[model samples]
Target: MHRNHELYEYLMKNSWQMTEDWYKQVDDPDPNSLYSTTDEHIINTLKEQNQDYFKRLHKIFIEQEEVFLKEFEEWTIELAKDQKHLDTAVHYVVREFNKTQEVYISYLQKFYKENQDKVKLEQFFLWLEIVRKTFQLSIYIYMEEAQKNTSKQIAAQKEMINELSSPVIMLQNNVGLLPLIGDIDTARAKLILENTLTQCASLDVQYLCIDLSGVAIIDTMVAHEIFQLINALKLLGITSTLSGIRPEIAQTAIQLGLDFNSVRTTASLANSLAAFNQ
Candidate 1:
């Protein structure tokens, strides 16, 4: 009976000590009902009961460690299947996980420096996996947000192109000011021609100015089109003046052998307007 009491006391003391150690290691005391807490408590109790019991507990712990390590190795292999040529978010997650493993290894080295206990290493390895999984989840969230932002920007650009391609502003009768915005693609050119021709016909403006100040570049096709439009306006008995041709464009025009015969060119809209008024 005395032996039984002594064994009970020793078991309780050892269980309490194990709990304290676990708390110190994790720094957070889980509810005693938690699986981890319950497992540790049971193991501690069994180990303190008899010498054979302690040996059995150690063997069980080793088995559990082996299973966990196998799982961990498989998880790591799956995560790093295609890290090198990773183009998508999944690949990016793999790469980040691989990077996190390096950090995890460093942490393990730091913690196991003095103790060199296999049990401690196993525990820490499990903890490291928990951290890695959490980090991977966070990276997935970040990638989702990045993809959303990219999609939004693409949608906005499409809307902007639609607005620019389809005429957003109506020309007032007798108003000759045409402010061009953005790159002058073929669609934009057609829109400009339609608007300008309509305005000229309806407004009966004697002097028409084609402003090119906002134009970034004038390729051969653009120059040829402009020349054709100018000749057509002349046939309609209207004088067309080209304004705001940059020196670079002038050079390109000369190089491309584009002739602007009898089509008046000016440095600015102000100069063109002054010439028209004269």
Candidate 2:
């Protein structure tokens, strides 16, 4: 009890110098790291944030574990959301975080040496436990935030790829051409249906030339979904023409009792478009 109070007082007195030294040690002015930014205002803000963290960390020794954890969680949540840390690798921050543990350990060891009678052996173990728990929470928050950010990025990229792959070219006024050039998985097929309908409506395409020249194969479910798109366009007062149906794919559709009699189809995209408005 007495050792805790004395150590708290000693830490409070040395907090400013400790914070400054810690900042100096971790400071990476290489312009690559989020903290060691070149901008004067950014550098100052990072320094302030670093100092605040050190102050709060030292207070953990004096405060209740629950209270400190609540505050630390809040601080780290902000750190996780910060664009600076998001731009940098978590491993970089991990390296810097390790330095802090080393620095504080050195401080604890020095305190133990000078006041051997005042500091109990239990205090060292207890302090290590607190540091370990706090870092565990920090690591969890960083990983969770990074994972969420990566998921969002991947979703955005997928959406972009869907849009690019299923392009509706304005081959003529009131006429559009959607050329499916790659493998049509179930997901991409669904995207094609949605994008086709949306683009047809938004672009005011009276007729859509769906060219499947690039597609070598498709499943029955995929062929059904595509025909469903055609049916949908028909209800919308729009005409849809299927072109460049590969022999194997057409046979698969026929074998599945799929009929193209209800919809117009051509052997080639050029022939389909050439027959447009004639």
Highest-scoring model, lDDT: 2
Query: How many residue pairs clash in all the candidates, one count each?
Result: 0, 0
- The collision pairs in model 1 are none
How far residue 36's Cα lies from its native spot in candidate 2, in Å, is: 10
Query: What is the TM-score of each predicted model, taking all chains together?
Result: 0.39, 0.78
- Which residues of candidate 1, in runs, are more than 4 Å off? 1-175
Model 1, residue 170: C-alpha shift (Å): 11
C-alpha local distance difference test of each model: 0.53, 0.79
The C-alpha local distance difference test score for the whole of candidate 2 amounts to: 0.79
What is the alpha-carbon lDDT of model 1 when measured against the actual structure? 0.53
lDDT of candidate 1 over 136-161, digit per residue (tens)? 64355445554565576678776567
For residues 1-278, write the lDDT of model 2, one tens digit per residue.
32276776777777667666766786665567776666788767766776677777777777887788889878877777777777777777777677766666677777778888766778777777776777777678767877687678779999999889998888676889999998898888989999988988888899889999999888877887898889988988988899999998888877888777887899998899988857
Which parts of model 2 have CA positions greater than 4 angstroms off? Answer: 1-52, 87-93, 247-261
